[model samples]
Target: MDLKIFSTLPILLLLYLLDCGSAQSPPPRGCESSLESVYFNLCDLNAVWGVVLEAIAAVGIVITLILIVVLLCIIPFIQDKRKKASVAIQWIFLNSTLGIFGLTFAFIIKFDQRTCPTRLFLWGVLFSISFSCLLAHAWRLQRLVRTGEGPSTCKMIGLVLVLTLVQVIIAVEYLVLTTVRLNNVCSYENKDFVMLLIYVMFLMALTFILSTFTFCGHYRKWKKHGAHIFVTMFFSIAIWVVWIVMFVRGNAELNKSPDWDDPTLSIALVANGWVFILFYILPELRHITCPAKKEDDPPENIASSQRNPGLKGVDNQVFFLEESNRGIALNFEDNLHSPSYRGPSPMGRNVYSSPQEFTIPRPHTRPSYHPTPLLQDPYLNYHNRQTTF
Candidate 1:
């Protein structure tokens, strides 16, 4: 009876294993007929989110191309010293815009052996180039306002290139190692790529710090520039925070279904790219394109002229009348004691005594007037009687 019981235990264990396997059977594979089913399957190109992402990326590419063309066309016409100083920054902006274009492609295209390296490598390098350029601009503004000297264009370009090259090297190593370990195939789990984004975060942090430093003092001379940089960096920080939270924490919690990972990244790339364009690139473009203000007339003079319109009009009329009557010459000796000359006139008591009178040629069409002196005037006899009244 003991031997029979031991034999029966093996049969019982087999039956239990079969029951568990049957209960935990995998679901059916292949596409479902329902519209909701089609939308949820991220791998399907027909997915509504995928279509929206593609449209957003296409629009970004179009806008970026238009900006690039506009920038190139206006290069020769940008004459403002500040705008000229930002030439390198504008070039980097174009490159960064293109990089964003490439990044969007990575999301639009299905993740595969062909696109993984493009996505991983370009992401860090491009963002580094852009933010480093911004840092250089902030540094230039700080130096100009604080020290009254800005870095040369070559130095600015070199700084950006050097900083960007470091990111390039990092991205290259990351890609090479990742690919080699994956046996030359580009397959990678999303978690593995998260580590590579650390380099981009460092660049963003550095840019934010530089922008913060730009606002340290009054910086009255660079107030506008500082304000733009501060606002841009603030927005960038907020964007990065939200995206990082969504990608790292939010995605994990929501990964039970077909992964929304690609869409999250796509949204981040599109949203951040637009933010940079609107806040940073658009403002710089506007500065370059807008006409420079004339400094010949001081603001005080302008404000005074605006405040005293009647005085300004009278002064202008007097100046033009004097100019138009330049050909007429008149003696002023007889008018010295006239009633119109009560005390001294505000127009200048000795207006006729100016040396400019010697240079004025008597016009042939006009006759010169020479009045007798007040001592010889017939009105002199009546002057005491007229004043007595």
Candidate 2:
């Protein structure tokens, strides 16, 4: 019994020593500590990548603001006779730009109950508004070119509002559901949030189809606007595809940290916003601001025509000469007597009147005579006798 107790004592002492060694050692590093300790805030300036994203977001916001200002400044000078009707589209575009700017805020600020809702709601609604505007624009172009009829500006605005309202409904439903189930925590799994994008995807698809049809149908008449819509849609689709893949699939394998999701979204917002600006907004702005070239006449011809209204008659005469089958001589001296002439110009200038008085000759009138054969012979004989003498 004594020997057994002595052996058990050493085993117990060894166990105690092991426990002491573990307690003296530092705590094991947690996943949160390792990943989150590096970032002091949402956009940690200490990290290079975070700094890059923040800078990009900041610059994007600034550019978006500038675009808004430019749009406002150029509204009066748009030179489009339909500027009143088109103002809705411009305002929608500005709203979209503002949405893009808002999206960056989601990344720049730390995630919380408030910001989470903003990130989720604004992203869906703002994007919907923008693409809805595109859809409206494309639809209008299609109808105008195909049927020579279009909706009124108010109807167009209504259409856009209806389209965007659908998205608003979807977002609200999502937020409400999330709030009820998650105890008012705005946090959502990326996959679930992405699923909410189904409606957005639908809007995008519709925009693409409408834009493609518009582009194909009116390529001849509305080449610039059609191409702009087509290219912008195509570019947006590419960006969406790439970012969706990265955010949903690639991030799991490639992301070095768990906090990369916001950055990914922020990057996408900036890139997609710039794409819209570069492809759609910038081109439209340029088209709006720049004066269109007149293909009918040269600048000098236009200037001369404006300066001298009398030359218009000469042009008309030249056109008439070119059209006529028979050659017609124009007499400058008799031009004042011509049917086309007025007594004097409004400016009191005697354009083609001659100073000298002239008269036209008339044919003389005479009685007709009939002669018999004897008279004709006598006359001929007398003429012959005189000639012989």
Candidate 3:
């Protein structure tokens, strides 16, 4: 989940400052102002942020890749394979790779000092957003498994379909932009303006659409399940909103003469990357399993356990019959003991062992007599002699 989303904040600020530097008129040092613009004023600061962001993002990329490799390492060992888990893992890799590409391209944009690379920027954004969607899908899968049946399967399918359409549309736009740039129709200025508008609109539309679905799904699931889904959806929506809003505002600032001294836009983008990990990816890290407690065992069989609990049988009657046949008596040795048995099928009466079955053994009598204390008493000597006769 710690995918260097927040780690790139300083870099994002530096980039935003760079963008703003281009938009605004130079500082009023007049004719004496150095030929080197404010953009390059702190040559060291830009390079420092660049190196730091690159290093952090690179580390994140490496970590994410390592995590993916680790997951893949043991995938073959799963006795009964989970197709959903496999799908989730594949998406995780795609998400991480896309994220790495975005960070790399962001560095490229910074180092090159040009906004003409629309395709890279656009694809970077698309990949970043796609990562979020994939993460949410993984979360949904977990929720579905945990709660048995999730809220309307139809809704989940619909949301994924919409996201797929958005991705396809964005991909087509990327192709078109790439083609346009190839034909030389879009120069540095036109590409920046056109690409900015397109990117903002695309992101806004995506954010709004996704927000609708996320909220609806969360709301429906919340009512059925609990507050967990609501919190998750809220954070997810917040991330989208923050990104879209900052993107739009940044574009607006750019259009209004270009000297917007703000770092919100870069922060927003970096935040978008991290927020997905926080809200969606983090939740899928662990799965819900049945609780482990000794008291969770069935009341009837708690005492039968040897400190360590074990499942006896599914059917109580079967368990009782097996125990009785094996000569294990279920008597009221303590107040905690319940002589009463609650089997799957209710019996008409309580049965006890026969007294004759406890008689003393005799050479001329039954060989398998279960001797009792009464037969060993001195008072039973007369009876023993009588019986010998």
Candidate 4:
């Protein structure tokens, strides 16, 4: 027992010395509680900007998912062929908006070699895609307002892709220039980033200018679409201006510019994503997918117009220019059954309006049927032919 006690004392004393040694050593940086801690950076409670941007990103993602689902649901019920064709452009535009929201998280995270390349590439590319979609839509609206005909679905999508491709090329070129040739993947200044985005800025400017023409065209009905685009571009331009100012010159004045960069970008991305959804996507869907109320329709007739498409109300108006021949659909036969669909029959005397007037009932047809037994008499000659009158 005495020998065992002596041996155990030495082992216990050695363990005590080891613990003291560990206690005297220095601890790691104050990053143990955050995800960025692993990278030796601040996050969560350690960084206010990071926390705020993270929360905004989460909300933006949820809203984006909801908008996507709503847009998908609305696609099938669009009866206008031209409007249905426009759905493809809306899809690309929405996808770009979602990418904008998702990329905000990348900005919120700590910048490093792995993320720097992606940030540089996607920042310009995604913005370009969004702006390009707006530009293509502006072009389509311009054409529709002028000639009452918009281009085909393939053409609109192709235009957006072509415009976006230029920015993709620019992004690739600039990324290689900074990350490879300069060997400064994570060391580029805000000015370098801003300079690379010049092409995207031009797209924004072009879209804004083109949207103004929506009111210049003869078709006043389509002015609403133009107004939606104009408002979206207006707010987007403001966001860009404020961010670009802060990202380039405003931060430098404050001395700790690097700390403000992520916040600026993250806020811009989130605000713009919401703007696109609230201003353009929702209103565009409401107008293009649902029937607009005509001011001329009586309260009683409103329900009837919705129940039947053949009724010659605003729903039956030649509002959408059919893409088949880029002209109005000539089937006025659908309007023949509506009792109140009558208008001054200029075509009764003019041959040019013959197709529209031919369906109007002859002046004497209604008078012949009510008082006379001709409608009920089975032996009446050619009764089947006379009933059609």
Candidate 5:
């Protein structure tokens, strides 16, 4: 009986192999009978997450373009050399962020050998570019706060590119090792993906820590920059935590590990890109592009932006108005309530409660006809001359 069963096992296995080979699975939803079935992961608008992410990334791309235009347009108007020096970093930062959004399209499409490696390689590159630019910016802020200046535009740009180069090398090595060496292009595990991003996480952590150092300096005006960086890094850290957990453990626990991988990464990309746009990039663009006020500006002819003698009195002067007609010197430093100053005149509202209007006294007049004895009215002088005659 055992020999007979063994002989029939070979035939049964062949039949099962043929049956399994003949059993064809249905195409992906919203993909059947479509001309774009080749790349239906993106073209399949019926896939809710793919459609939503595509729309979001499209919007982000448009907004980034508009901001780039605005940044370029405002560059000519930016008078401060420090701010002007920052333009290159800002441009690099914004374009990297745009790449982040644009790269989302790769993830939205179906995963193939080519798409997989492209996604893996570009993911760290774009993120590294953005974080390195941010690192340079935050470093500049700290330096500016401490020394009241920053490095030249060339030096800052070089620093950013150098920092980003490290990640590029790492990403290239990772891509080659995983795709070419191992011959596992699209089959790379989730852990492998996270491992490839370790350098990027290090950059992010460094950027987050460095951003806080802006407060250590004396200049508090730029402390708002620290706050902005802090918040952006904070939320980014949180988003990373959630996605890493889902990608590493939660998806497997829920029995959706392989299926959820694309959505997990796609969602993280979209969320973090928006965070960059909303938290860091928009605020930075607004700051660098704002119209300069006269008080904050140095004279046009002066070669040095530091020789701001005009700002010296801004802290001390409570009310200041410069008109060439009549010099009404209202020195309120002596007394807040000068006796001559009753109240503010009804012409306009006064900032201070008591107005310091200097009252000039009228010279004494002898009579309506003459004031000085020698220089009396012309008629009186003529009469006196007639008397003399």
Candidate 6:
């Protein structure tokens, strides 16, 4: 229908012709209509079904390639040094190994040529990179807790290197064992389930270990920084867990039904949506941990903030001094009287301009008021002192 599809038409026709030619030439040992169940082959593939499967797988392969390319293109431009390195290395692993090679092998490669060992090996490599990144994430958490610094490139690189090595070893062992056992193109069912079981157990163990460490780190953050980090970590881990669970359930259901209508795909679609939300949306949802940088703010903005010209509450000492200085003017007003004499004096009765205002004396720097004796007693020396004064 489209140019892309039209371009692929020739290749698809060639593949179909090759399949037909190979079928006509091949009649192995007792592999005939009798042993149909024992050796599963593409001879059972209906024309429509085969075409549809190829289209769907092709779409998947294209999407995976686009994601890899986008990641590769974006990671280099990230500004944060540590995050940039982590993202770069992570994109390299995802693009080159997990996305490109794995998708090509799983979806684009001819079904008859594809082997169980190859699928398992690719899966191991895929999960290994994912798990290693997760472990590095855990290690970063631990480092942050012990010392208040973020993750380093050394940490990420080391973990990725170790994980790649381990995955390669496991893949090689399975490859060797399968080649020995199958002695030809290997099908999915005839592969050793025990080796896969062991590998899965190892993966699960590592996942659990990393998860525990991450959880502990989250717990520590919750204790120290309230529940903000806890909520963020919850969303991150929850999304990934959902993805894993959906994948497992989907695979199991596909094994049983072999139909594309298995609910696992829906769950996987949901998980992917959540994963994007966790990575992109959740960070936007949460408040930034770091404060604004100096360069981000303007100098004029700082000056405006500094120039807050408004009156605040008066100080007690300043108010007291002002009140005291103003007290003498109001002391003899019409409604006022001395404390010792409640009855109004002649001076207090006048509300008009008082004589004190007409000829106001230079105000005394200090009041000359002194306390008088409480009573005139015979034993006291008050009489003699008064006479001398």
Cα error, residue 203 of model 1, in Å, equals 1.4
Under the 3 Å rule for N, CA and C atoms, how many clashes does model 6 have? 0
- Report the C-alpha lDDT of model 6 over 1-389, residue by residue, as the tens digit: 69999999999999999999876664344335444332322223432333344344445555556655666666445553434444544454444332423233242223344444455566556546655554555565454443334567776778677866787787777677767887653544412433453543465456445444444432243122213233434453555455455455545555743343222333332333234334432342232223334553333454344464332233544564455445544543422343433442344334325534443122333364332223122223423443454
Per-residue C-alpha lDDT of model 1 across residues 209-234, encoded as one tens digit per residue = 77766665433446567667778778
Tell me the tens digit of each residue's lDDT in model 5 across 1-389.
Answer: 99999999999999999887666444566666534444666656567888788889999999999988998888888866777888888899889989989888888876876688788889999989888888888888888767667778888899988988998898888777766767886677788889889988998999999998988865555677667788889998999999999999999999997789889999999899899888987887777756555554333433243566666576333232222112222322222254543343442233334344443322234556342223322122322433443
Error of 4 at 245 (Å): 1.0
Once all C-alphas are superposed, what RMSD does model 4 give against the true structure? 16.6
Best by lDDT: 5
Clashing pairs in 3: 23-258, 23-259, 24-258, 24-259
- Residue by residue across 1-389, what tens digits does model 2's lDDT show? 99999999999999999999875653223223344332334434454555566676677677778887887888777654433466668677777876786577666555776677888888888888888888887887776554434567888889889988998998889888877897775666777778878888888889888877765442234446667878888888888888788778788887543477766787788888888888988887777665545553433465566679798788875565443312211233355466654343332222224445433222222364332222112112323443444
* Residue 267 error, candidate 4, Å: 1.1
Relative to the unseen true structure, what is the C-alpha lDDT of residue 13 in candidate 6, on a scale of 0 to 100? 100
In model 6, the Cα lDDT at residue 373 comes to 28
Cα lDDT computed for each candidate against the true fold? 0.68, 0.68, 0.42, 0.75, 0.75, 0.45
Rate residue 144 of model 1 by lDDT.
55
Best by TM-score: 5
Task: Kindly indicate the candidate among 1 and 6 with the higher lDDT.
Answer: 1
How many clashes in each candidate?
A: 0, 0, 4, 0, 0, 0
Off by over 4 Å in 5: 1-38, 291-389
Residue pairs with colliding backbones in model 6 are none
Stronger candidate by lDDT (1 vs 4):
4
Who is ahead in lDDT, 2 or 6? 2
What is candidate 4's lDDT per residue for 230-303, written digit by digit as tens?
99999999999999999999988988688888888889998998899889988898888765346434323544
lDDT of 3 by residue, 2-82 (tens): 669778888999999999888664543322235444234223343344344444455556655664565555455444222
